[model samples]
Target chain A: MTERYVYMDHSATTAVDRSVLEAMLPYFSEEFGNPNSLHIWGRKARKAVNEAREKVAALVGADASEIIFTGGGSEADNLAIKGAAFARRDKGRHVITTAIEHHAVIDAFHWLEDQGFEVTVLPVDERAMVGISDLESAIRPDTILVSMMYANNEVGTFQPVAEAARICNDRGIIFHVDGVQAAGHIPFNVRDMGIDMLTMSAHKMYGPKGVGGLYIRKGVKIQPIVHGGGQERGLRSGTENTAGIVGFGAAADLASMRFTDGSIEEEVRLRDLLIDSVTSSIEDAYLTGHRTERLPFHASFCIGSLEGESMLLRLDAAGIGASSGSACTSGSLEPSYVLLAMGITHELAHGSLRFSLGKDTTREDIVYVAENLKKIVADLRALSPLWKNRG
Target chain B: MYTEKVMELFMNPKNAGRMEDPDGVGEVGNPRCGDIMKIYIKVKDERIVDISFETFGCASAIASSSMVTEMVKGLTLDEALAISNKDVVNALGGLPPQKIHCSLLAEEGIQAAIEDYRAKRKAGVEAKA
Candidate 1:
């Protein structure tokens, strides 16, 4: 018999919604035309692209003109960080970001550092929160940008983006928020939050992959990382991914509709059920992210003496799709930097597992997952020599 | 990724559990690296009569431990000592490059068990004298 499959790795990538796919279908074949073309077909393609821009902009409260579509979330982040930093080169050589930012933002800052830009990687608290006071202290006359993630991908803890943005605004330092993981799951308004620039991806929010957008608040100058035919306001230059952009627009619209319809609250309820069941039933199983201040659909844990890869393998055998921050899973000898940044021991970090739910995730799915996870963890622990010491 | 043989062995290892009052026990690896294997052996007349292992690691580590135990069962102490990591790797068809360390740990675990058994035997003889 085919095993029952349960996907609990939405944070990694979500399945595209049906409506989003439906909206994208016509753009791929019948309505295929270069948006830059001036013909009727081109006008049709350009109209769809512009409508997508509006839908995406409406999702984040940004003006349609300020939205720059890119290939994916990482690209958006790179453009936001490197573009802004390079554009302001003569003004300052300093940048500030949290250590827990995704590798996209972190690596961009690292590249800037290699190019002689001074970068201050502020440490996070035990709950994976960067200190506002530290941000205030890190700012200097030369600090050109402060790029912090709106939410952590691995742990799901929401960061203080508003406060961070305000601090940067006061210092005249450009603020960029990597909102890829937080965009659809949480309610956000870039204008209301005073965000100078923000990055978000479509695939993380039930939209097609290979499509993402960077929101640059009006008058925020940034150099283009990819130079071509001046697409996306010359900030990102390439033929627009017409189908992907349409799908993204549909996904964004759906996300906004769901937000108003109270579907996210249902997700949160099921998420808490999964979290409570696993943490309470299993010995030495502890939640990794913040207890209360976290994404509604995300739950992570580190079970003592159980390697994440082993647990993932067992979970896979049981037909559950999950992700892990364990060193073994990553094929590296080091565990997740996010957990390590949170001051978790390497041993505990090796035991990390993350489960991010989705809109279609039902109570039955959570119950099945919680029940199987208990057995899987216990069985793996039985095979674990380290587990012998836990008792 | 792992071979079907590795997955099969990992799913139902031949001898997995702690042996009560075993003749000797060997433990290797550490929790920091997310792999630890403890092998217990019961020897009779200088031949291995029984063996079991408790391992904490990815699928390859557990498969290596299970394979090594199956290979050494019923063999004399000298023959068991001759089992190499390469032998364990070959016995399991093959392991990934990074997983070669799992076989090495298995080899070291068996050797450590034999050493512990010899030391215990020598101590027992000394006590009688």
Candidate 2:
């Protein structure tokens, strides 16, 4: 029999779409030209970049001029946090963020702190949802920037984006969001939500890696962190990644189409099916993220007794690809900080598993994974010293 | 990261389970630390006749446990005690630096089990005296 490989690690990264690859192919070879050059070839390349910028902007309902291309999600996050922090330093030296943010945003805040900026890290509830009241109370006259993730990378919990934006707007604080995991999965208009700055990655949404964008709302004052020939309006300097940017544009365009074509709804259905199957069939399994207020295609859990890396290995052997935030997987001594912050015990946190479904996931694949996961969990638990009963 | 031999052992461990009515049992590591290994050994004629392990940890930990048990079975108690963490590591090709601790756990577990068995025999001898 042939091997059955099911990829459910979309949150980590996705397989680039065929259409996106096709769109990017020309720019890599024949159409390859310096976008800054004044020749005809340069003009063609420049036109492609402009069109890509428009497509990326349209994905988030931002104006094309408001979007600045960055190297990747991490770079976009750094640009937003550092750029805004430096620009508004004269106004205030205080910034705010949540405890469940990805390393990109959290480390940026840490760097800002080293540079003399005081940071207020807000706590989240058991479901990993940040409290709006916490945000309201954390805001001070000295607060200049508040960076929070739109959706958690580990648990997929959706933040109180609109409410946080409104609060920041009332306080005249520049609100930045790490939308790396949420951009194309969740539909949101940055302007309507008053989000001053948003970070997005191409690889998370079926685009090629090495390309990302930051949406800076009009009139939002932010300094440029990268210095060079002033490509991407000087916010980012260096030659633009022509082919990668084209791939990102194509991926975003496809995501826009999926949003309208009921494909996203179908993905939600598959996600729910996987969640229900795994949680119901496996004993001592608990869903980690908010059930309703999470990304439609993401499902994470903590299974008791067994560690995450072992589970991932067994699943991979069975041709199911996934990821985990367990200490073993990270090569760290501690389990996932997000789970620990959400009140999960250290023992349970070590058992964390994340399955992020994507456009290619199907019902049969989900069923096969669930069935195999049940057996895997049972088999692993049998070899667990912590497991007392066979069940 | 793990070697091919490590994955082979983890996929199909030589001796993996609990031994009911074992002469000695030893447990090491902690659940909070994300790795715990329990080893059981059956002794006869001063030799380890049977061995089994239950490990709640990453692939390296599981593989280490399996490799240690395979290395010790049918050996004299002294010979089994001489098997070091380095031996377990070498037997499994090699483990990642971060996972070296897992091999140490396997060594400690077997040594603990042997110690337990000796302690039981001493207790019985003292009781008879």
| Model 1: reference contacts kept, as a fraction | 0.82
| Candidate 1: tens digits of C-alpha lDDT, residues A1-391 | 2269999999999999999999999998899999999999999999999999999999999999989999999999999999999999999999999989999999999999999999999999988989899999989999999999988989989888999988888888999999999998888899999999989899999999999999999999999999999998888999999999999999999999988899988988998999999999888999987888899899999999888988888888888999999988888889999999999998889999999999989999999999988998888888887776534
| Docking band of candidate 2 | high
Q: All candidates' lDDT scores?
A: 0.92, 0.94
Clashing pairs in 2: none
Cα RMSD of all models vs. native, in order, equals 1.2, 1.1
Please list the residue runs of candidate 1 whose C-alpha ends up more than 4 Å from where it truly belongs after superposition: A389-391
Q: Each predicted complex: what DockQ?
A: 0.83, 0.92
Q: Write the per-residue lDDT of candidate 2 for residues A1-391, one digit (tens) a residue.
A: 2289999999999999999999999998899999999999999999999999999999999999999999999999999999999999999999999999999889999999999999999999999999999999999999999999999999999999999999999889999999999998878899999999999999999999999999999898788888999998889999999999999999999989989989889988998998999888888999998998899999999999989999999999999999999999998999999999999999999999999999988999999999989999988898998887773
lDDT for each residue of candidate 2 in B5-113, tens digit (9 for 90 to 100): 9999988887998889999999899999999999999999999999999999999999999999999999999999999999999999999999999999999999999
- Cα lDDT of candidate 1 equals 0.92
In the predicted model 1, the residue pairs found to clash are none
